[model samples]
Target: MIRPNMERPTMKRREFLATTTALGALTLVTPGRLLAETPVAGGTLVWGHSETTQNLDMHQTGTASTSRVLQNIHNALVTVNSDMEVVPQLAESYEVSDDGLEYTFRLRAGVMFHDGSTLTSEDVKYSFERCADPETGATNFEVFNDVAGIETPDELTVIVRMTRPNAPFLARLAENGAGVVMPAGSGDIQGTTPVGAGPFRFIRREFGNEVVLERFDDYWDGPAHLERIIAREITEPTVRLTGLRTGELHMINDIPAERVAEVEGDASLQVLTWFPLNFDFLNFNHDLELFQDARVRRAFDLMIDKEMLLQGALWGQGETTASASFPNDAARNTDITQRGQDIAAARALLSEAGHPPGSLNVVFKVTTNYPYHVESAQIIAEWAREAGVNMTIEQLTWADWLSQVWVDRDFQMTMMNFFTIWEPDRLYFSLWHSTGGFNYRNINVPEIDALAEEARGTIDADARNALYRRIQDMVSEEALDVILWFRNGSIGARSEVAGLDTLVHPNGSNLNFHKVWLRS
Candidate 1:
């Protein structure tokens, strides 16, 4: 894991923010070993969800907000732990073939789904098939690229044979959408309501306001400590803080960085801070003739300073980076320098692309789902205008953005921010591959495709990491996308809330409230 050990920083907030997710020191002022005390159950915990969930169908949704809540209501075949290792969750145990092509998973015995159906190998097979089905419109269809066949040897055992050796195939299964298992026919009706054999089960979603979940005593892993959890949507920072302070909320995730000191100073409130494996990036649609020129794309990237944007848009809550990989990742090419803000250089690039500064006019579309996305886009738009580039900002609601910008690929340019399970294959293959499942930007290049295939099949850790580094270098040098920063998150909670490690205080920021409890 990239998470650093907590230490109070001696530097200023902005400078310290760059040192090991720099915000880790914020937790020091929190009292009473919060979330480390003996667990107790039977209380309702209302937390402020950063955004509204698109849907409960985990496989079909692309947003982290959806997975954040679905994780509490669903179980995966395997899961990532605090240490970032792949371990069994729904599957009691699993075995892999030495050839790195076949896997055998034994489902936990006597597990029951929310609808009282017993979990069997069939359920696992059904989930994978549904996710792989193009008709299902799942976000993780590419995850099954190596699958030759899925077989159920018995009621409890599922065997998967790959068409070719896939080194990270097992690890990919631990990701939210790919690994999540539901009942045989659950895929048919997972939109408004979903069912699974987990510590919590779906109760109801009050549209844009909130989604509710209740404890499941029949869960194979045992019941969640809280009797109920309400994920209330409140995007405004001030409103969320008010709810938290007024005792209307037990916890608030993604607290604005400016309020970290205040939350930490309150004796009744505690802060939970960590570096989330998430990023904000600018994407250019290759289908658009304007973005087809690499020089034009580079010029757009050069117009704005990533550091300035980080502080302006996020209050310096994250680390600046140019590649899809995190700033501190080993695979990042450190030798390549991220260009500073220079209007002269940017205008020169536009001239080289045959579109002089005044000649370049484009539309930049962004989503309102994340306030930072709109804020950062506006910041950069002003910079581009100063560079003699005529730019317009068009904001869309989350649902419209998903269809117009993501699925339809109908926009010239856009900025996106998201979090998910991180690995070489998950990061590179899903975004840069010619026909990647999530290649919404239409980044189709022969070299990137070749390197992605090679890296996906390469088994040795050191060899594959080198290949991934090459991919990162190519993506950045070609300006496939402008990755501005890797986000660090802070969660504010009442001191009475404990067992956070069991919630989102773990790998990939995957949420599982089953293990967390409210101190009585």
Candidate 2:
């Protein structure tokens, strides 16, 4: 991870206020002018996002860009702090039953939706039920599948009973799909019109160009400092960096690794780095005969040099992955180190698996959005060829690749990344479960299914952690997936920007906008 020297001098409050006041007067001031005039109250913050969200339905969409947008317009029952701790949002306090099957939440009083409707337990119930509905197209239905029922004793109290003990229930509530809470009886109007109690209220969206959000005056926490926010979709990485440098954008997400040095060297911009709880890995088609053999999978893992990929292709922006997921994860197995590059061992293993020459026809498919993905695929293909494996590379548009290569399972292997949060139950269970939607036809392991089930059924943190370690070890030894690397988080902001906190979970839903203010 890139570490910035924290001891470097920062502008003091008095200097910041004076500068902001001058800038605010020179520039057109709006509702959030306090962020400019007072240097703390508020100002509009323009953010350039790298990708456009496919859908606005928070429950249905799984992309991080969409989640960031949703987080601004919708507030969950709970929120995750910068320190990766779960905190109360709409709910003031919560209590868990001794058996760990029931959760009771007391709502914060006087919270109201943008429509001037007061929040109640009924809204919370409808929100969860809508999320649990299959027809709702909620991408994270698996997280709430164990819910037996939801009960509201009063307007401010919500009780939830689960079919089994779940230790990560609160963490799941802070996740992408579960973070959005809609008004009661508003199920039919979700995608068309969404109303929530977040700092910003949705105005309108123009596909592929921008999404407009206006600050809510009656926000429970306090009035947002920013009068307005415009999320622009700028797909090019270089264009994003240039925009930040030129002051065309207040902030830009997902800065390119190659331009990090250049951007940091510029006096007009400041670069922030955070270690995200996310990783990318290679998924093998286990149903395919060639990949069904554990020996063949192990041979493929030994062929690629992870360190070279991280340093050369990734530009030293990532950590070599030992398992299919992040090592810092609570469920990760610390005992197993990643297999180093050993071409000889790979060749021998391939021969033992009946591929005498260690060469087999393989295809690598990747999406075009993340240029590094295609680059990584090419590097891996070259390494495989050197290790006596015949490989073909194919690049496809994001939509086509998702539908054909990934969902359709038409390729021998594919490169994909999971933007994970703090909860491994959802991360591991969704990726490795026998019936997991993201399993992508590679769910043939009964042992993994059992382990994941056991982990989900336990409420104790230590027991659940032990279960995760076992799962990691099992997948690593079996070569279920060839883990590549865990990516680092990078963002470019103008020098005048402040309060931009570090991101612990790199799921793209950054939450510091509420505290961020512009220095005049």
Candidate 3:
């Protein structure tokens, strides 16, 4: 049995100190700028971000773009605060039994949904059951599968019995997709027309254009200070910057690092930067015969230079690591051998694997949604070619890529930026665990699967960290995926926009519209 590493009790919190410290320094508004401005209760806040698929059903489609909109339109049972602590949202309070198997939640009284339906324990049961159901196709089905049974003793109380102890259950509840709570039996919620009990109410949506939300006066916490919130789909970063300059958009996400100084120089705009809990990587389709050999994967990893990729493609906006685990965690074992650009060694490995000089062809897939992806792909292809690997680049639209690569899983390799949950253990489960919904790589190492299962049940943080360390070492040695870099995120917003930058969570629910108000 694994033992908890109690020597560093507060290590997890301190692991994020550097990143959080930088965020504190970067998110400051122009001095004395907003001091005289009082938050007013009326104007509509118009925000813009990159466009992705829209499945209005928050539970069904867990895309980051859709979750940003849903964060306001619906409230989860729990939420991570600005400090990154998981706290109850819809649930007034909760309790767990000694065995860590049974959890009871008390629903907050008098909370109202958009349709005037009162929040009740039944709604909680229905929402969770639906997520656990295979037919619902909930993105978080695997996460919610621990629910052995749920019992509603009364209108205001819900008791959940887990099949096994799950340390990250509450943290999972705070995630973007799993946190959302819809009315019981609200059949097939659409993105265009949503019925949520959040501070914002769904008004309308024009696909490829914008999604509009209005304030819900009956919100349990309090009605949103703004009368309305509009999330406009702006695909081009330059156009978004122009929108910010012309005052067409009040806030925008993902301003390229090259433009950071320009946005910060403008007195009317403030740049909010933070080291987001996300990383870009190249995922290998292990089912492909070419990648079936671990030796070939290691060869592919050694040929690429992560530093060049970050500098040339990302404009030095991120940090690189060899570990599959989140680098911010202290539990991440840094003792593992680091792989760097070694063309000769890579070529030797490839040759030893029976593939010599241009004998193998590999397709590299990427989407044009983020310019960095295409740039990185080009650089990676060049590096691979140096080792005599004939790499071909394939560009697809975001939607098309999602269908073919994510859903159909018919590709050799693809590049993507994925987010990590606040619950560190869930990150491992989501990527390495066999049942992990996002484990598109189809990695099925028996030892890794056993560790993932053990990690979930191990409540002691230290022991969990130990298991994760071993897991990371295994993944790194096998070169399961190439973890390129950890990204730095920024939101470009008008000086008048207040509270928009206060809620930055790793799960991509950065926009907290309820707390945002226009300064007068």
Candidate 4:
């Protein structure tokens, strides 16, 4: 029932200029129909992606731009609900062994892929094998490391064996790309045009312009609310909002801080704001001799003025944060939040590092995909100059930034927001651990690796929280990464858009549109 949709509209430069914009997603809640106010389906949605997805391979793509769209086009053996709890999706039921080393999943019957094929345990085995293969290069490889082997006894039953007990193992299964299941031996097809058992199916892509998807009638959970979705690649925030305002687009994202008041006043637009699970931080290339010194790193960390950043870049829209860890456990102070909010400890630390004042000059690479990031970097550059550190801001397009800064690792320093993930291990183990699969910055501290590894194996909440607290202290004292603040995310849409209440995303970052319908 799935085929390349031929109805995609081609756009010229002037047409593109008028309709360009972006969309910001939010926390996952209940699956579709929870906000049932009586549904009216069947309409096209022109959703916005501030950046185009360079990697369509969900099994390996680390970027949110790719995974957001892929979320609608695929399903995994397990997924999360509105409570952010791991639940079954393609797998109707699952059980864990008492030893916590093996997981047995029973596949749901009649689950169909985009290519008109029924799902089987063999497909699950193939996908798991791909994650185990180092060649796949999945971002959250640490999560899959516990997976020792896969055993498929029958068409509907599959078992996953783990090397050790992992508390967050099931939760990680709800992550993007890493947990996605596709047809067996269709790895090549997934890298280009993916086929999965999602409520929607991929149609075509015009390379950095737009992606099209059609509703899957044979979906196991039933048909989706919307008939078609067009994810438009528009990098400019103003242009995106303009399209939303003019009714050329149904929804927009990444609303600029200055435009918040305007969107709130407009009766025709609906403003969605939430305190997202994310942090803005500066990433350093540890391979550089200058960053190898702990003192230099601390000096840069101390140079951050959180108040200035919140006001200047985010227009004081978010709360300031000094801690390196998420504030999930407040009772134990597991976050290890730096109570002494100081932005002027640089001079002494720089002196101790043996670097003469004004001897350091570095390029802070930032992505244009996120408007706030550029503003944040600009503000940071000003503070650096006061501390005798020369700073040059280097702006790169979203695709280029992903390749040069994230994939190629040719950048000296960069800044970005950590994507929304509920678990601390998902946040720290992949980025802070020395041998982490997604350790793009080349951070190689044996202590961080040891502490994070210790936390990963521990399932007890109290013990794990204690270990994470130590990791947080180490990250702050050593200045592993200069975390600036807790960011607030905003999403703007037209008044006519409905079913968004049903978009219970798994990782709190991707946009699932199965329940999102247009009001007729």
Candidate 5:
């Protein structure tokens, strides 16, 4: 196991926002207790996940299941810490040119890849260039579109020149796939074979069951204390909770809301809530004629009550919001008023959109796996009935939802959570920009796209925030999508597991195992 001999994290600043996530507050462990305790080495940490993952290739799929294991397998140039601040990981330090288009990164000398190969600037160049390559088909290729060129002046230095000044460029580099440095000239990145320079090395992956990784003894900083880390897929929540209670698993994620109290009551278990960085929303398929009318879209937003959905579906574990952006975000429009449940107003809008009684018929597509999606759909269908619209619910698997809604664009409305990235550009611009690769909803507002592009180039923080504020207002005014509640993420683990309660990342997917150790 590789351990980073880095500086201890500073006290969290009050400026730091309690971000969004699907998890709620934890009751068992405190940061002070974990820090004050002595760490013991050589124990295996077994984690339970709710879904099956195909491979460790983050470049292809950015799913949470893949990230939970891959973060220990790959090291990024920059990474976010528990305080939600971006810190250096692989690169020792970085500087931006005065022109704002060039970023120079100094690679750490002693870092080593999982294959026992020494880290060099060439590997860094290759890792990024591979993703930027048009032929590689990286899911986040759009993030690298501004890269004009990459130059490796020496074995320890690499410089990236962008075609335009992108203010969110550095934050984007800290993102999952964009941050990881892979081996140069390696075989297919997405294939079964895997290698990275993180704390743990890939031992084996038992498809649909678990992924096993052992500590790298020759790690640059030092060998990790834990002998092994196993990420197991236990799709059933009850089974996962049982595993933690029975001491079969050290940590588990995606704990059900009703189980929070039960876990808290157990002295042997701990529930750690992550910052809010997740939201479940109904994404309107703008390509469909049924959602083309602005009044019709607005009617859907007004008909359903966000507070009721939060209480009934989420079990009152989330916060309601009117804007598409995270409520804690600096750029979020605070003035935008939520339409609140107004059946009369919703009916008037529907009538204006020429959708009188029984004139509107649509299918609400949702997933049965995650929280709130199924429950929210059922409640939405009831609300739709009162608004003189026929909305039927159709539950599909995650894979089928991806193929049918994201790829085929065949759905009228689909419910999915936006596991937002830390940066506003990725969270908003990537999903709403006209040319955005992930823009599943056919939102092609030229004005909004222009503003989004403008914000990307604005180097000043205040200026960029103002631009995002306008964009959020525009998105809310148009009702392009329903802005649901921001969710809290939780980590259910045994009381013996330490260090994990201190770390926090957006979506709680980027689990850092280096600091994690079993208490003696």
Candidate 6:
């Protein structure tokens, strides 16, 4: 469903404009009238950027946090609405051929890039082609793998021919990587400069300090309300909280789990929450010798207490999950709530797998920086010990965790979280596809992969949902990955801020910034 954070009520458009205008007139008539009378249009919003993003190239990085910043300064051919449906953005509209292999998009007329260059179908063709190239190192290349070729008949029309029918093709176009569209003759703008048709224009970036964006008055969607937005990098939760408390920051993200109560109690601060499609779970590396046995995987799954983890570790902020896919997804199987903490069942399964008590050496990998990861790892390790399984915990930083542990599959199992979207097709296909880059070599049943292909090719919603349900059940029964919990997405904003809608989607990028304005 379309779950948006509604805790902060929205003001009527007429009332908001009246208040802003009155305040603007009053402030402008003061001693510093020049600054105040300037339409209340220009003000910098200081936002916290939690992590250090190495690359600003949207195609190179599919992480949500990075995408959130990129979307303001870049534009996609199409945009995903709050309901997870595709809406026209750069392309005014599109039509699918009867066979569903060809898609023709009509580009909006008179759209200009931030650099004053007119947008053309050639740029669209070049951008998609570049993203599909293997040398680009784009994490989202697989999304467009179905495209056999792209053709631009004229300046305003672009046609894409797919090798196979892809039902989720339009949704994929709304992804973050899809927003990185550039001019045709830009000549490798990835590492150097980024030009796009977006509401905001990039001015300057100070690494580790802040990123400044100025309003694009010539934006195709009409001028944005805010004049400038400054996204600052503040990794520490306490520092971010302090900034919000002292009025130094307009907005902050990734609120500390412990401070949820305090933030909610404050009258001057507003806490926005949404049920995101993100799922945190334990991923087993089947390539590892110890994790190869299905029985062993099942035994490990039974050894952990998910409910207790949600209560004690996550502080009830997360919901228990049975299916590897998101619970809210139409594809999820609600019937199977697999293996709770049953030490006897776990021990028997271990015996059946020929792994005697204390014989199995299982290493749990987690990032040292994430508090929830540390808590969950400690609890699971203890539970596994109780079930007579020898377990050890290994912690690493974010960079080391991704490169050495995650990429290499160096550990027996690792605690990882996926920031999924509302659609199950994207989540299921990405995590379970045999050739999926992020699958991390954990394909157990080829049948499930075949089912995924079948679902992708099917256009009917009911048929596709049925295929997804079967895949979910098959994966859960086989114990491919131990489903843990679904965490809520949250954002903290000052009381003066209005129209702050946040959702649980990755990066909280689905926010509607167009209607937001400062309260008088």
Give the candidate number with the greatest TM-score.
3
* Shift in Å, residue 296, candidate 6: 1.9
lDDT tens readout by residue for model 4, 361-459: 889999888888898889888888888888999999888898898889988789987765556676678778887766888998888888888876776
Scored by Cα lDDT, where does model 6 land?
A: 0.70
TM-score of each: 0.93, 0.86, 0.93, 0.90, 0.91, 0.85
TM-score of 4: 0.90
Q: Against the unseen true structure, what C-alpha lDDT does each candidate score?
A: 0.79, 0.73, 0.77, 0.75, 0.75, 0.70
Clashing pairs in 2: 19-520, 20-520, 32-42, 34-42, 35-42, 42-225
- For residues 1-520, write the lDDT of model 5, one tens digit per residue: 1222221111222333434233433334533354476778889999997766654676766466677677778888887655555667788888777777788888888898888798888888888888777677565667787899999999999999989888777777777777688888873844575788888899988886898999998777688878899889887778988898888888888777667766766666777875464666778988877788889899999888889888888777668877656555677778887778898899999998888967889898886656468888999999999988898888987667767887788899988776645478877677788877568888898998989888888877678888888888888888988878777677788777887744445434456788688985
Off by over 4 Å in 4: 1-36, 324-326, 329-335, 339-344, 504-506
Worst ten-residue run, lDDT, model 1?
A: 2-11
Q: Please provide, for model 3 over 171-289, each residue's C-alpha lDDT reduced to its tens digit, 9 standing for 90 to 100.
A: 77877677677889884754457788898888888877898889999999988789988888887888888998899998888887688877778777877776654678888998887
RMSD of each: 5.2, 8.4, 3.3, 8.9, 4.3, 8.0
Candidate 3 regions with alpha-carbon error over 4 angstroms: 1-15, 18-26, 29-37, 190-192, 506-509
What is the C-alpha lDDT profile of model 1 across 1-520, one tens digit per residue?
1111121101122332355545452343457673435678799999998777886798988888888888888888987655455778888888877676788888889999999999999999999999998899888888898899999989899999998878777677877689989999888789889898778989999877999999999888777789999999887778899999999998888887677777878888877777754887899999887787888888888898999999999888888876666444445566665678888988898888788767778889998778888888899989998888888899998778888988889898899876733565878888889888778999889998999888777766667778888887877788888878888767888877887654662444566788777886
Q: Report the C-alpha lDDT of model 6 over 227-345, residue by residue, as the tens digit.
A: 78888877677888898889889877767777776787776777775444257888888887667788888988888888888777767765777875544445567787867788889
Candidate 2: misplaced stretches above 4 Å? 1-43, 324-330, 351-359, 502-511
Cα RMSD (Å) between model 6 and the true structure?
8.0
Model 1 RMSD, rounded to 1 decimal: 5.2
The model with the greatest lDDT is 1
Question: Which residue pairs of candidate 6 clash?
Answer: 276-504
Cα deviation at 19, candidate 5, in Å, is 10
Predictions ranked by lDDT, top down?
1, 3, 5, 4, 2, 6
Error at 279, model 3, angstroms:
0.9
Q: What's the TM for model 5?
A: 0.91
RMSD of 2: 8.4
